[model samples]
Target: MSKVSNRTKIAAALVGVLALAGSNLVAADPLADVQKADGQIHADAAASQKKVDKFFDQAQDMLFEYGTVADERESLKAYNDYVATLVADQEASMKAIQDDINGVDKLRQGVVPLMFKMVEALEQFVALDLPFNTQVRKERVENLKNLLSTAEVTLAEKYRLILDAYSIEREYGNFVAVTTGQLNLDGKDVLVDFFNLGRVALYAQSLDQKTGWMYNPETKGWDTMDESHLRELTKGIRIARKQGALDLFALPIPAAETAK
Candidate 1:
């Protein structure tokens, strides 16, 4: 072959070799690139996790501070918004870190709203003070005592009949209805009214557990229920207040019945 042709052929072969080497070099470090990308994703995911944690912590602190109306309302709104924003932002983040976590975003959704409601209830309770020695408080307590007595007598009699009439499943429902119904048979809103009245009495004693406020039949005077009984009784009162069941402070108290 001619030297020029030979040189051209050698040049063409070198070009082919260079192109093949370049292709292999490009293919060599795919795993390294993947690892670098993974590391970056992990770092970003960690940053997002920090943001999520911050939001939750802020929410928790606000919930604990939810005593006053203004403070609670403002803090609650901010906390709720932060949680909601986190949830909204989570969808986009989930795709990025699906392999790293399982249902982390969804877990907050159920918990956050419930916490929000609980704080809201506590806010209402603190804002609405109970009436203790006032006529409304005194009259309501007497009315509840009367209603409880009447209901206890009536249900004690009818409970047997109810048990005879209903199946086991139906009887359970009947029992609850009979118990609560007897409590409500009299025109008095006994449970909630009594709870509020009792709460006021307890509050007046300055959170003292030793003070008893139940009616003392022998002394004919109200005696402290003591700390243990007070704790039990106050739990119901707090629950009623927190659940907004005791929001009828403006309602007129039922007239107390004369003893038979």
Candidate 2:
């Protein structure tokens, strides 16, 4: 009975040891599971931080691109304003040029008719003036008339020529002149030296220097000069020809008619 009791105690001790080992294994499994869950939480936090850093970098790039676009837009606006001002100035200049063109056309129309009347008046004046250089003066008037009808000459040039002709006519009364020509006395052409004293008086002397005649404007005829004036007339002729020194001499001049 004692031996059987000892065997039963040994079996109870073995069962107690197995129960303690199983309880220790259960507690170690729960600690391992908690450590694994903590590691997974740390990994998730690191991934979220990486995603935030990438989003921040993209936002910075977008801000820089927006600023660049704004600056370019302002620059383009300034350039467009400058171009608009230049176009406005060009338009104003074109308008002024057109106005000047219109004014020139009007001036041309008025000037052309006035030139014709001036030419006609000049021809009449030359025909009625003293007969000295008659043919040359008449031909000058005829040339001006022909020039008026010509298409090659410009209006300004024609006006200048006409003014020059008038200027020459005005200068004739300022000086004495002498020319050799024929005189119709007794209906015969006789060679004579003609002397004019500033459009005041005209005289003719034969080549022999023995006789002289005065032109009578009243009758349009030649009248014999007194023999007493022959020497003085010859001296006057010499002075006119620049062959003798300047000196005073007496000659017959036509009397001026009183205004009636």
Candidate 3:
């Protein structure tokens, strides 16, 4: 009986040892599966973080490019505005210049007819004034008439010449003058020295100083001067010619006509 009991105890101890070893192996396999799943999760997270970092860098680059574009647009806009202002100023200046040109044309039209009337009035005044330098004065009037008819001379030039002629006529009334010319007396031409005392009187003396005459504006003729006045007339002629010193002298002048 003792030997049978010993063999059974030994078989039971061997079965317990095999069951404990199987349990340990199953637990170790489960633990190893959990560890592998955790490792895979950590690797996936690291890869996702890398992708996020790349996306953030791309976004930052886009933002910088947008800012650069915006600044360039502003600069271009300011340049365009400046150019537009310059164009506006040029347009205004051109309008003003056109207005000035139009005004000049209108002024030219009015001034032309006025110049003609002024020249005509000058001719009439010269014809009615003192007969001294008559031929030259009439010739000036004739030349002015010819000038007015021509197209070669400018209006301003013609006007300037007419003014110069009027200035010369005005100067004639302020001084004495002497010249030699022919006088028609009693249907004969006589050589004589003509003396003009301003616009006051006109006298003629023969070359020999023997005969003298004064102009009669009332009759438009030469009146024979008396022998008594001949000496004074000779002295007056010499003074006008600047051949003698200035002195008081006598000559007849036509009385001014009263206003009618």
Best model per TM-score: 3
The lDDT ranking, best first, is: 2, 3, 1
List all candidate RMSDs to the true structure.
35.2, 7.3, 7.3
C-alpha lDDT score of every prediction, in listed order: 0.47, 0.86, 0.86
Every model's TM-score: 0.23, 0.60, 0.62
Task: Order the candidates by TM-score, highest first.
Answer: 3, 2, 1
Model 2, residue 110: C-alpha shift (Å): 2.9
Question: Which parts of model 1 are misplaced by more than 4 Å?
Answer: 28-33, 67-260
Question: Taking the tens digit of each residue's C-alpha lDDT, what string does model 3 give over 25-58?
Answer: 9999989999999999899999999999999999
lDDT of 1 by residue, 1-260 (tens): 89999999999999999999999999978978999999999999999999999999998888777656678788989999999999989976887688445665565466445434533443343334232223443443344334333545553343333233223322222221101111122353222223333322222122333332443223323343456555555455455447435432322122233110
Judging by TM-score, tell me the better candidate of 2 and 3.
3
* Candidate 2 per-residue lDDT over residues 157-207, each given as its tens digit: 998998898888888878788899988888899999999876677789998
